[model samples]
Target: MGWLTMTRMAMGGHETPKAYLDAQLTYERKAEGDTPFQGLRVLKSVYSGSTYYAAAERYDENGKRIYVTAIICLVRWNPRASDGHIFGYKDMDEDMGPCEASCPRSVLALLTTTSHPFALDWRRRCYRMLALRERRIADGDLIRFPEPMKFTDGSEHREFRIRRDGQKTVLTLADGRGRFKISRLLERRFEIVREPKVAKTFFPAA
Candidate 1:
């Protein structure tokens, strides 16, 4: 064992994989207004080499129970610092399936057993919510104009300002002359504007 592992063990910090997952999920629930998840019950657990996998039933916000799987690998880092080593499972990988469809047979074999009925709606809402929260414009976010810009809305602009137009997020000229919509493209990425090839890349303000 490495020095870190020895220290963690000496500190009496070992924790069952199930216990660690439950704690992590609880933290997520509290952050999202404690909705979408009624409860979680682990159905089966298996170990392969240094990795641990678990399958469970998760009740979503709509009171629908669905099958979920998680994979955790042992690590030496202590995320809580003071909290004794719980095997560092902060980066567990998760997948949700009704089990009958969607999941691979190899992974399903671990679960030993699935509704994806709300899969589409739930995914859309989850992504939109995450985008709105994380991809939002904040002070010091970078904005670049590679060329002069024009808008179909007949709005003129020299600089941009971020604001919301109802449920949609928009970038309006700082002078309030023109506006354009911002879209979430993929995880942690946004399409600010395309016509002028303006780059919305975010660089930490120096």
Candidate 2:
């Protein structure tokens, strides 16, 4: 419904929240000793009319977590608009705080980043994980989230995932929970947004 559809593999009715996710995501398992939490994610599952990327994550006290990350690229939406852009991030931390978010108004006033990776523990995420394909931070200044900044592209960020009855290409990412954020550099300033995405699939060889 929102920019991204978030789903966490069930982990035993909240009791073993982390374990249940592991079982549900048998096809997307990560290596052992990756992180202290467990989570998974699938980005850009539906990239049609309302396009964006889907991201999700799950955490547990057993030191097991999974994060799913991917993008739901749009095939055709307002074709006349400029080519869409995807922000490249190396790592995200809780210290980033409620990065440029669009959700319940409570997020705007509450201490959202108090527990977030980018805002809380940045080093563990930014310096450790998160490999970026592109970096646009050089274009503009770092603008904090919640401060209204416009994205010119026609495709507004609204992420969703459609598993449907059975689809093969539905790729689930496999990795740890890395803090997520987005930055767009203009002529003299850069704008930052909050975009957290985790992987649901595990690449043992990777």
Candidate 3:
């Protein structure tokens, strides 16, 4: 597992597969939603010069996390295609499937050919989870947007700021109870309200 640090390199200018996928998962539609980024977390990953293989965790219907495998390649994400622009780079492609005995053929082929330790450990985790009938995420939950702060009394601040708390990015208020994710603010709908006027300097003219 420690070798992952040394063997890993930027794939398509992204430091990790999760970052690459999230960057390409944006959408611009009338029914804009953030479900694509919802509860998706990458657990184990390995990549060749062109192909990326990884194990991902996703929440199922019963609020249980399930282990899934994915194969992401540049061929699956074509820039010249219209669907790639309309949906997402990976949304239109059939690139992911289960990680257990019912895994997809594409993932199976890649796994069989490679002797990478990360890949082997990833397979072991898949089997172990399946055997226990528990697919709980080993790497913990995905980064989630925090609850928006409520301002029930109609009090507002003149200015605000954004800052990071460890792995989380949050917006701050001068006198608020807790920090809020920028995404949460966007979801809650924010307006400029009013801009502060520039202060005039009093100086003697020469």
All predictions: root-mean-square deviation over Cα?
Answer: 17.4, 24.1, 21.7
Ranking of all candidate structures by their lDDT, best first:
1, 3, 2
TM-score of each: 0.29, 0.20, 0.24
Taking all chains together, the TM-score of candidate 2 against the true structure is: 0.20
Q: Cα miss at 140, model 1 (Å)?
A: 69
Residue-pair clashes per prediction, in order, are 5, 58, 0
Q: lDDT of model 3 at residue 38? A: 41
User: Per-model C-alpha lDDT, please?
Assistant: 0.45, 0.29, 0.40
Residue-wise lDDT of candidate 1 within 11-121, one digit each (tens)? 344354445444444422422564443566555554433444455556665546555644433434444666644354323334332221222234445432223334443
CA lDDT, candidate 1, residue 74: 44
The best candidate by lDDT is: 1
User: After TM-score superposition, what is the CA distance of residue 23 in candidate 1 from its true location, in Å?
Assistant: 5.5
lDDT of 1: 0.45
Candidate 3 lDDT over residue span 1-206, tens digit each:
01121112324566554466544442222323754434444444444433444445454545466444444433132335443331122221123222323222334433323355655554555454444333222211222223334455555443345455575555556333445443333223233323366899989998
